[model samples]
Target: MRGKATVLLVSFALFVGGVLALQLERGGVRTTLLVLVFAALGAVAVRQTIRKRKK
Candidate 1:
């Protein structure tokens, strides 16, 4: 529960940051970090969903 909440919050922050970063430019480290952040969030979400179904 706590872990999910933390991931959700962090992902939200990262998304917001990513949007801001996008406003700055089109491609760079910020954009890459944003993509990585989204990928991380997706992985966490899928992992949690799988864990829940296993139980």
Candidate 2:
């Protein structure tokens, strides 16, 4: 429980920081980061699916 809570807190903090940074920069940085994040998430999801199928 403690570990889960710590992870949640850290994730929330990072999300808030990202939002703040996006607001500060209305240029390509925001778009680039958003694409990178989505690509990373998609890769993780695909990897998990492949592993589950292997099992």
Candidate 3:
């Protein structure tokens, strides 16, 4: 389960990096929203991973 979570986190990071690379020119509201959404997802993943570790 931990390994799966790690893979998920890495995949999310890569996806966000790809999005950022594509939006490198004209960043606007959509890019900002995407970043925020991804950040929230990352936070959730981190929280869950920590919770599992404490178990």
Candidate 4:
């Protein structure tokens, strides 16, 4: 479970990093969408981590 959580956290970090890179390079509606997608993924990952920790 810890391994899974770690993977998810890393994935979320990568996703956010990618979105930031896209925004920096492109700067447009597409970048906004990527940012939103990354935000959602990060939120889900955080929630899962918290739930697993509680267990």
Candidate 5:
């Protein structure tokens, strides 16, 4: 149950991100936006790992 929900959430995120990236016309902004998105994703992953380990 949880696994399926997680997969759907991740898929939705990727789909939305791809669409937004395509809509951006400027190269610099697009690159910056991608960097920010990855940074945010990495941060979330790290936070989740730390949380799970503490339990």
Candidate 6:
């Protein structure tokens, strides 16, 4: 239950970051950083889900 909630929160954060990145000008470091952060969040969410399911 908590794990699911965490995943949802992370996903929402990633979505918002992605949207903000899209709205920003292209070819900037901020956009790249946001994308990297989103990717990391996604990876963490996936890992948490898999770990919880395995347990």
lDDT by residue (1-55, candidate 5, tens digit) is 7955785587569657856976899799887877776766676677667867998
**Model 3 ranges off by over 4 Å:** 1-27
Q: For residues 1-55, write the lDDT of model 6, one tens digit per residue.
A: 8967887887787778777777777777767868697778879867987887999
lDDT by residue for model 1 (1-55), tens: 8977887788788778767767766668867877876887788778878988998
Better of 3 and 5 by lDDT: 5
lDDT of 4 by residue, 1-55 (tens): 7877787777777777676667565657667767777777777778778978999
What C-alpha lDDT values do all the predictions have?
Answer: 0.78, 0.65, 0.72, 0.74, 0.73, 0.79
30 in model 3: Cα distance from truth in Å? 0.1
Find the candidate with the highest lDDT and give its number: 6
TM-score of 2: 0.58
Q: Candidate 6: which stretches are off by over 4 Å?
A: none
What tens digits encode model 2's per-residue C-alpha lDDT throughout 1-55? 7855765565566566566657766678888776665665566557657867998
Model 6 poorest ten-residue lDDT run: 22-31
Residue 48 CA displacement from its true place in model 5, Å: 0.1
Candidate 5: count of backbone clashes, pairs at least 3 residues apart or interchain? 0
Candidate 3 lDDT, tens digit per residue, 1-55? 8867786887677677657656666567657766776776787678768978999
Q: For model 6, what is the error of residue 14's alpha carbon versus the real structure, in angstroms, after optimal superposition? A: 0.8
All candidates: TM-score: 0.58, 0.58, 0.52, 0.51, 0.63, 0.67
Pairs that collide in candidate 4 are: none
**Candidate 6 local distance difference test against the native:** 0.79
| Candidate 5 positional error at 2, Å | 12
RMSD after Cα superposition, model 3: 4.1
- The residue pairs in collision within model 3 are none
TM-score of 4: 0.51
Rank order by lDDT, top first?
Answer: 6, 1, 4, 5, 3, 2
